[model samples]
Target: MSKLPLEGYRVLEWGLWIAAPTASMMLGDLGADVIKIEHRVTGDPSRGLDAGYGSKTGRQSLYEGFNRNKRGITLDLSKPQAKTVISKLVQTADVFITNFRQSVADRSGLDYETLSKINPKLIYAVITGYGSKGPEADIRAFDGLAQGRSALAMQAIPEGPVWVRPALGDTVAGINAAFGIVTALLVRQRDGKGQKVETSLLSSLMFQQTSNLALHFIGSIPVAPIPRTRPTNVMLNMYRCADGKWINLYMPEADRFWPNFCKAMGIEHLRDDPRFKDIWVRAQNSEALVSVLDPIFASKPRHEWIRILKEHGCVIDIINDYADLPGDPQVIANNYLPEFDHPNYGRIKYPPMPVEFSATPGQLRRPAPEFGQHTEEVLLEVGFSWEEIAAFKEQKVI
Candidate 1:
C-alpha cells in the first residue's frame, strides 16, 4: 500500500470529548503520529460517557470511535513541570492542537503564542466554541449549544427551533479544524513559517449552512424558509409506503418529471389536474396534492415503488435510518463504513473519512489507546529518561 499523505508529521493534542482529539484523529488517519494528552484524574471525559446510556462498565465506544490511530498519555497541566514537558514536545512537533477555553489556555501557558515561541514552525490549532476574540470566547460550548447559536437548529426544524442530534456541530468543526491545519502546513512549506489556525463549532456550523445563508444575503430577498413537513415542491418530499417504510422523491423540475412520475405512480390522470397543474399550482396546493397521493403511495411497498419509479427514471430513494445504514448496498460498495476487529468490541465498524486519495489513502493504523497507555513510550521519544519519567509520575505531572 502507498504511504498516507501525512506521514512523517507529528501532532501533539490536548483535547477532551470531540473537537481537538477528532482533528488529531484525522491527521492520524492520514499517517501522522498523534500523541493525545489527557488529564491524569479522568483521562478523556468521553471515555466514560457511555455509562449514561446504561453501559455499566463505562464502555468507551464513543471515544474509541473518534480517536482511532493515535497514542495517548496522561498529564496534569496544573503542575509547573507539565509546561516543561509540553515545551519539549513542541520543539519537535509539527502541529499542536488544544480545545481549552481562552482563559484556561492563557493561564496554563498552552496558548498559541507561548507554544509557537518554542517552535516557530509549529502549526498551532485552537478549537473553540466561538472565535477567540469574541465576547463568548471564555464560555464553554458543546455540539448542541453551537448548533443553536449558529441557527443550524432553526434550519433543521424549519417549523420551530430544536437541536439536531448526533453531535453534528462537533463533527463538522473537527473536520474543518483538520482542513485548516493541513492548509496551514501547506502555507508553511511555501513561506518557511507556521501560523496559528483557529476554528470553532459556531464557525463550522455557520459554514455548513452556507447555502441557506446565501439565499438570505446574496439573494437580497426577504427570507421564507421551507418547512420539511410541508414542503412547497410536492415532488421534493418524503412519503410513507404501505409497509410502513418511507421514501423520498427529489424531482426538481415539476414540468419535466410530473408526467413520468404520475404515470409511474399510476396517477397519470392527475398530471393535468387543475389544482396540481404546474410548479406554481403545486406549491399552492401541495397539501391537497399530498392528501390525494398519500393513500396512493401507501398502496404499495417501498421496494415496489422504488422499482417502478426507477424504471420510469424518476429520482427517488428509500429514506434510510441509522439502523439501515451498515447493510446498505451503496455504503458497502463505497466502503463508507469499514469493519475492524477491535479488542473490546470484537468485529466493529467505523465510518471512514469522507475523502479518498488515489496514491495516499487514509488508514486505520491502530485502535484508540488506553488512558496513559503510551506515556512512558512517548515521553522517552521526547528525550525524557526513565528516571525523569518516574519522577514526573510521582509528581502527578506526566
Candidate 2:
C-alpha cells in the first residue's frame, strides 16, 4: 500500500474531550504521529464515559472511536518539569491542538502565543465553545449547549427546545477543526511558516444551520419551528407502514417525481386530482394529501413500499436505527463502516472517515491506547532518558 498522506507530520494534542481530540484523530487516521497528552490523575474524562460499543465490559468504545491511531501519555502539568516536556514536543511538532479554556490555558502556559514562541512553524489549533474573543468565550459548554444556542434544539422539536442526541455539535466542530488545521498546514507548506487555527462549537453549529439561517436572515423572514404534523414540502416527508416501520421520501423536485411517486404508491388517480394537481396545489393541500397517502403507505410493509418506490425511481430511504446500519448492504459494500479485530473486544466495526483518496488512503493504525500506555516510549522519543523518566514517574509527572 502507498504511504498515508500525512506520514511525516507530528501532532501534539492536549485535547480533553471530543472536539479537539477527534480533530487530532482525523489527522492520525491519515498517518500523523499524534501523541495525546492526558491528565496523569484521571487521563481523558472520555475514558470513563460509556463507549457504547464492543463487549459489555472493557475499554470505552466511544473513546476508542475518537482516539484510535494515536499514542497516549499522561502528564501532571502542575509540575514545572512537565513544561519542559511539552516544549520539547513542540520543537518538532507540526501541529499542536488544545481545547483548554482561555484562563486554564493561560495558567498552564499552553496558549498559542507560548507554544508558537517555542516553535514558529507549528500549526496551533484551538477549539472552544464560543469564539475566542466573545463575551461567552470563557463560559463552559458542551454539545447540547451549542445545539441549544444555535437554534438546532428549537428546530428539532417545535413544541419545546430539546437537546439533539449523538453530540452533533461536537462532531461537526471536530471536523471543522480538522479542516482548519489542514488548511493551515497547506499555508505552512507555501510560506514556510505556521499560524494559529481556531474553530468553536457555536460557530460550527451555525455553519451547519446556515441554510435555515440564510432564509431567516437574508430573506427577511423570521424562522418558525416546524410542527411534526406538517412538512414544508409534501414530497419530502416521513411516512409509516403497516408493519410500523417508517420510511422517508425525499423527492425535492416535486414536478418531476410526483406522477411516478403516485403511481408507485398505488395512488395514481390522485396525480390528476384537482386539489393535488401541481406542486403549489399539493403543498397547499399537504395535510389532505398526506391524509390520503398515509393510509396507502400504511397498507403495505416498509420493505414492499421500498421495493415499489425504488422500481419507480422515487428517492426514498428506510428509517434505520444504529443497529440496522451494521448489516446494511450499502454500508458494507461501500466500506463506509469498517471492521477490525480488537484483542480484548473480539471483532468490532466503526464508521470510517468518509473521504477517500485514490492513492495514500487512510487506515486505522491501532486501537485507542491504555491510559499512560506510551509514556515511556513517547518520553524516550522526546529525549528523556530512562533515569529521568523514572524520576518523573516518581514525581508524578510524565
Candidate 3:
C-alpha cells in the first residue's frame, strides 16, 4: 500500500459547485477517504455541464480536475429517508462540508448543530458567498459577484476590472476552506474535539487583496493596472527580447543588473543620469527608460535574451502559455501529474496532489465515480438493509 498522509481519514463532501467540492477535492488529494454525498437523480450539476465529451462525460473537465480521489454517493437529503441515511453516515465521517445558505442547512437539518452532535470530532468546513453572520449572509454569491464586490477587478485592470479567465474566487475560497479544515483537524488531534472551520468568497477575496485593503485602510492611494510586469522593482518589468517574446526580469534593485539594465539599452551613461539612478527615479521616468529598453529587448528572441540574461546574471523567466506548459521542466521534475486508467476515459491525465512528504505522501486512490455510482454500497454500509435500500431505490429516494 502507498503511504498517504491522510490514508484513513474520511470526509463527507456535501458540496454542490466548485467552491465547496474543490475543498474536499484537496482533502482527497491528501489521501483522505472522501465520500461525496449528492442528490439522488440530478447528481452534482457540474458533473455533466461541459459539451465536448457529450452526455457520457459532460463535466469531465470540471470533476476530473478537482475530484481526483473521492467516492460518490447520491442521497436526496431533502427526503426524510435520505436524511436519515446521511445522519448515520455522519457518525462515521471525519469531516463534513456544505455550501448552501444557512437557512437551507437549518431546514435540511444538516447544520453544525445536528451533525456535530452525531460526531463530536467531525471537522465541519464550508464556503459561502458572504458569511453566515453578515447582513448579506443569507444571500447567495458566486465568484464574479465576490470579485466585483472585493474590488479585485479594479485592482488588476484600470478600465473595467476584468476577471481572470478561470473562477478565482471559487478556487481561492476552496483552498482557504481546505486549509481551515486541515487546521481544525490539527486542533481536534490536540483537544480530542472538532470545531467548525468556515470560509466565504467575500473573506477569500479580502485575503487576496490584503495589500490593497491595507492601503485603503491607511488612506494610501493605490495605483491601477497591477499586471506583474510592473512590479515594485523598477528594473524588473516584462521585456520583449530581440525575438519579440516577452519574459519577466526579476532582480535585486540597485544591483549589478541595475547598471546592465541601462547599458543593455545603450544608456550606460544613464546610470549616473538623475532620472535613471534609483528605483524611484526610474519609476518616475518609466516611459523614458522603457522607451529605450523596450526596443533593445524586441531585437532578439526570448531564448537568446534568456541566454544573454543568464550570462549577465540577470534573474529572468520565460513567460509560459498553456501550450508550453506540458513540457515545463519543473512540473515534470516534481511529478506533479498522475496518469489514471479511467473507466470510460482511458489513461486520463489528472493533476496529482501538490503537496509532498518524505514518508507519508499523499495519493490518488480512485477516479471520479460515475453518477450515483456508490448509492447502494454506501447506503448498505450506513446500516440500511437490502430490502430497505431496494425500497428506497424503487421509490427514487436513494
Candidate 4:
C-alpha cells in the first residue's frame, strides 16, 4: 500500500469529549495508528452524558463518530503499574494528545514533563478551555463562555450568544492540534525530535474571528449604517419558506447576485426600485425588500425556489439540521460518512477519515473499543507480567 501522510505514526489519544478526540480521528483518517486510552469502569464522561434515546445512547454514536480506526485500552492510571505501562507506550508513541486539565494531568503523572522524559521525541498536543498558562487558565471555560468573552456572540447575534448545539470549540481546536501535531511530526522528520503544541477554546474562538480582533489593533471597522437588530439580519439574511424551512441568502453586498436574487423571487422590479438600486438605497430599503420577498418566497416551496435559484446561480443554501447533514448528496459523494461493524453494536455509522488519498486510501479500521479492552495486550507489549497486571486490576488501578 502507498504510504499515507502519517503511515508510520503511533498516537496515544488520552482525551475525552470533543476536541482531543476529533484530532485523533483526523490522524486515523490519514492512516496513523491511534490508541485511545480509557478508564476501566466509567470510560469517557461523554459516554454517559447522553440519555438512552430509544434505549440507545448518543454516547454510542459519539464513541464511534469521534474514535473510529483506533485501538482502545482500559487502564486505571491511578495505579503505579498503569503508569509504568503508559511510560512504555510513550516510548513507542510519536504523538500524544490529552484534554485533561493541567491539574489533573499533573496529578495523574501524564503531564508533558513526566511523559516527555519517557519519550522526548513525542509530539505532545493539548486542548484547553482558556489556555494552559493564563490568569483564566485555572478557571473553567466552555465554548459558550469563550464565544461570549471573545465578542463572537455579541458581534454576530447580539441578543446573547446562543450556545451552539454542536461543540465548535472542540472541533476547531482539534483541527489546530491536528495541524500542530503534523507540523511537529514533520519537524521531527527533519531534526529527529519532538515539540509541544497547544490550543484552547478561547484562542480558537479568537482565531475564528481574526478579522474582528484585528479591528482593535488596526482601527475600528466601518459598520454599515443598516438599522438591523442582529448581525444575521445584515444585507444577506435567511428567509423562511412556505413549508417553514429556511434558506440563507448570503450576498453581503448589494451586487449582481442580490439583484439576480430579487429577480428570481419574482420581484425583478427591485432592480429599478428607487430605494434599492445602490447599497445606500438598499440599506434604507432592507425592511421593504424583506417584506415584499417574504410573501413571494412563501408563495413557493423551498424545493421549488432552490431549483429556480440554482439555475440562475444565486448563492443560497437550505438550512440543514443534523439529519440533513449526513444525508447530503455532496457529503455522500465525497465519502465523508463511513460505516463499520462494532463489536457490541453490530453495524454502525461513523464519519470517514476526512483526508482523501488517490493511491492507498485511508480507512476506519475499528469501532471504538470496550472499556479497557486492550489493557493486558498493551501491558504485555511493555513487558509487564501476568502477576503484575492481575495485582493492578485487583487494586482497581487499571
Residue 271, candidate 3: alpha-carbon lDDT: 86
Q: In candidate 3, which residue ranges exceed 4 Å CA deviation?
A: 52-59, 218-223, 226-234, 242-244, 252-256
Instruction: Return the TM-score for candidate 1, rounded to 2 decimals.
Output: 0.97
lDDT of 4 by residue, 82-118 (tens): 7777888999899999888888889989999988899
Which candidate has the highest TM-score of all?
1
User: Regarding TM-score, does 3 or 4 come out ahead?
Assistant: 3
lDDT of 3 by residue, 315-363 (tens): 7899877667668798778876667788777786776676678777776
Model 2: colliding residue pairs: 51-61, 51-62
Model 4: runs farther than 4 Å from truth? 52-59, 215-219, 222-235
lDDT of 1 at 262: 89
Give lDDT tens digits, candidate 2, residues 1-398: 68999999999899877998889999999999999999999888887777444355756867888998899999999999999899988998999998888899999999989999999999999999988996888999899999988889898767899888888988899899899999999998999998999999999999999989999999988787755356666778999999998999898898899999889978898889998888888777888888887898889999999999999999999998887887889988888888878766778887787788888899977888888999999989989899999999889886
| Candidate 1 residue pairs in backbone clash | none
- Please name the candidate that would achieve the greatest lDDT relative to the true structure: 1
Instruction: Estimate candidate 1's alpha-carbon lDDT, on a 0 to 1 scale.
Output: 0.89
Q: Give the TM-score of each candidate.
A: 0.97, 0.95, 0.91, 0.90
Clashing pairs in 4: 74-372, 76-397, 76-398
Q: Which candidate model has the greater lDDT, 1 or 2?
A: 1
The CA lDDT of each predicted structure is: 0.89, 0.88, 0.79, 0.78
lDDT of 1 by residue, 1-398 (tens): 67789999999998889989889999999999999999888788899888878887656888998899999999998999998888888998999998889788888888888988999999999889988886788899998999889988877555678888888988888999999999999999999898999999999999998888898899976555576445789899889999999999998887899988889988888889888889998888888888878898999999999999999999999899989998899998998888888887788888787888888898887899998999999999989999999999899897
> Looking at candidate 4, what is the lDDT of residue 230?
27
* Ten-residue stretch with the least lDDT total in model 4: 223-232
